[model samples]
Target: MGKSDAFKALIIGGSVGGLAAAHELRSIGAEVAVYERSVGRTQARGAGIVMQPEVEALLANLGLSARSVSVELRERQQLHIRGKAERYRAPQLMTAWDALYRALREPLDDVCYRLDSSLRHVRVEGHDVTAEFPDGHVAQGNFLVGADGIGSATRRLLDATSRPAYAGYVAWRGLEPESAVPEDLLDLLSGRFTFFESSGMQMLCYLVPGANGELEEGSRRVNWVWYVNLAEHDLPRLLAGRSGRQFEHFLPPGELRPEIVEEVTEQADASLAPQFAELVRLSDVFMQPVFDLPPGRILANHAALVGDAAGTVRPHTASGTSKAFGDAAGLAAAMEGWTPRHGLPLRRLEEWEAQRLSHLVRVSEIGIELATRSSLGVPQGDKFFASD
Candidate 1:
């Protein structure tokens, strides 16, 4: 599709990937519409995400600058095992997911974003795709993009074989402002990345500067995530109490297990150095499931899968958002002059799939290996960050 083609494209899901696709399509002169299931102005859900260079590059290509999101770029990461420090230098970033989403949604003006319009089904013919919403509304477009998510309606309507498989672990994550945090912990964590490891669990912590480049009240906050292994039978108790009260671990703006919170606090108090322990003591905690989806490529007439919708890798690599944005870029490039009638060039789609599959496979393999090693109390050493 050339710039003068005037094609209409419909993107399902209004998150990062969907918004990026919408922006990319609009840049190419295609009329675009985004259907998101969420209602108006709900905060972006999820914990802090590490946006690497590639992700930053993609956002820049979409006309989104780093200043829009208060990106915190780090040059060094410190690893602590049994209370000793081991440091490695690498280029990484820490930022809230909601902030990144808002940044991406800022530059789009021509795109029509429809909230609460969840996709009900998709009918793809030889030269066009029709998307049906649950409210009996139908949208027709020259092409359709499924940026929905792990449980995508487009994926389900297209390929019923692909399913998300649980990776047998869950993550507890949260953020706390600097004022709420203690001074000693602030000194150790304010300027760099840090990780603490122990048997059967691990904690990753880093400083995300406030929106104004200062760590003041209601501005800068420390982002933390704790990965814990869960047995199958214990899932219910962890998910909800017997009284139907949801067991809160990592979802922000919710209650946390007092006992679990105190246990983690105590662990930091006794097992960590003074600076690191204070970071934990002064911080609030949250938790979430750490699940991975099956690995495979989805082949459709005029649609393709990207990011977690295709497959999910564990966050230990912190590469999900990066992969999604990268996938969007590739799809935009591949379909530059293609259409539903002729379909995206088989070779080009295959190439995109190959690139995404190779990266995601490596990430999943490393996640499994690390999970096993962490379970066995094996030393990860400095090589963990080296692979990136």
Candidate 2:
């Protein structure tokens, strides 16, 4: 049999990382299928991302045009603790999570992607991998990939020892249309990436396309994030839903309690500048408790972990998407270099393990530093600390 016909891959998760992995594996001549848990479309957080190089390369590989989907910011403005704004000449391509999702999803074949399917368990028989689904169906393949996000059931099965530990803070994210807010506010936020950092807290904002990927001037939306420290004991109170159940992951809009939301708004008004605080107060808000994942190898059995399922660097690194792209690229390269009987996935996995471990260390460190940057510190010497 030809290499193309020799193996099949079953992928868990259909977000960006999973989709990218599907595309890359298919290109390397493996039969590929993706399994996602949601019945409807993915409800992304609508947050903005600084498109790192790895993501750009993935887009180029698919021959997709990003101009219609992304916004290019020519400079960065940091609101210093001294009550002054400093503009840096760092340019970046920024896009919403939903926009990037659609751009990447459009190019993938619909036939191979499965929604409303979740992994219940996996059975490995020598080199063969079979995934058991909650719906009582089974899919067997030569390779299996777990691209599920941080709450990954795959990570639970493969690497049970590593749990997502709270990182002492949470990110409050919001997005609003340009027309929905005041004109002066839009002018202040448009055309540049802006950040406000104070006593270990940070607020960052940028512009991105509107709902359904609309990218016109006034049609676009503004995306912002506020990173605030919350004591560990108080997290459950904020995560309490309408049903009163405390959640550890993300909280949907309806589940957000009125009292907690009101309290957060009051805190914003008190702590943030009036203009910036108004921006947070006026917009819809949600919470994501930050977590730290120390780096590790993703390969195990004939199955591998792809994207966030593998490891998650803090959002401060801005390398979350880029790291996922690199994982997909590295897997494709290893598969392409395969030689029947002579192929040693173990050796290849070892090489990838070392490379990604080192990569995540550098990335996570930079993220920690940025998240904790203080005005009391030395002048920003190396801009590398601010890179993706």
Candidate 3:
């Protein structure tokens, strides 16, 4: 690698973290390309995300307006089963994953993003890296980033031993359009973050931008997530899709077996607060088992891992998106002032890894503590990802 060589970055995983990295690196004049495994845009994945400064910075850097895609939130309330509510002032911004995705990707041309490009192999030669795809396509760049997420193939190249550990619980999630929400339900859920906590179960709901990032009153969505405790042995059964094949990550909409849906519906009606029970009953739902990945090395040769690829902190931390953006910002900053380098800047990469790994360790601990405190069935020694 010569000082005059343009910094060409190959980013794996086209989700929030990877796209954020592309924008940040591009702002620094780096040529970047992103590869996503999904054949089409992931319009339905992910739910509500609490606004963080890092997200705002990423959007602004990309020349996109965050407010155009976000909703202002004013308070947090605990909704009791008896319909009583406990409220507190907690101002924040909330956005949907799809809205942010559309905003970040709006500026990038198709040439820079490859859909359906699943990574099969990665080869590192000095400061240069090459990514091989299953369809016989190969991409080479000055550097490689494993922003592909928790199951990142690039992370395997860095440290194969680390994997996402199950958190002994699964989150049942749904989104209901404001237009479709009953006026009473909207009255209770609109403009505020509401929670319902009980023994081994927790539910929360908030408003997020609606279709095509619409922020109007009638176009917004009521996003809810219900975390339910599940014994480890019962996880596979719940993760099994309609095809009878078990999924390791999540059960997307319409994938849950009919019986499973019935069981959850019954549980919601019996155990959840009246408002939440109605919300769950009225909307189609999906399930994602919570998982935590203990911090580990995030770099291998010239390749670096970011976002969930580095470590997956439980959702209670509310730091997943922030952590992804933080990782992107840190990496971009590390590579910012480097003049033409002869080889990979091993020391700088190490510094970024140290900072990020430290942050991940702290966040992971917080998630565990919060989940345990919530009585979500997380037992001692059950914090690591189990490899089948």
- The lDDT for every candidate, in the order shown, is 0.67, 0.77, 0.83
What is the Cα root-mean-square deviation between model 1 and the actual structure?
5.5
Worst 10 residues of 3 by lDDT: 379-388
Q: In terms of lDDT, which candidate is strongest?
A: 3
- What would the per-residue lDDT of candidate 1 be over residues 1-388, giving only the tens digit for each residue? 5555566788888888787777776765667888888788534446567767766776687666564555454545555654556666665557667677766777765568888888888887766889889888899987788888877777888788877665555665667777787675666665577776666566777766553344343477787776655554554445553344764323434455565567657755765555556666666655566666777765577677777777777677777777778777777776666644454577987887788788788887886787777662233321110111
Per-residue CA lDDT of candidate 3, range 202-295, in tens?
8999999996799999999999999888777888888889987788887888888888888888888888888888888888889898887888
Ranking by TM-score: 3, 2, 1
Candidate 1: which pairs clash?
1-336, 1-337, 170-290, 171-288, 172-287, 173-286, 249-286, 249-287, 250-286, 250-287
- Candidate number with the higher TM-score (1 or 3): 3
Clashing pairs in 2: none
RMSD, one per candidate, in order? 5.5, 5.2, 3.3
| Candidate 1: worst-modelled 10 consecutive residues by lDDT | 379-388
Candidate achieving higher lDDT, 2 or 3: 3
TM-score to true structure, per model:
0.83, 0.91, 0.94
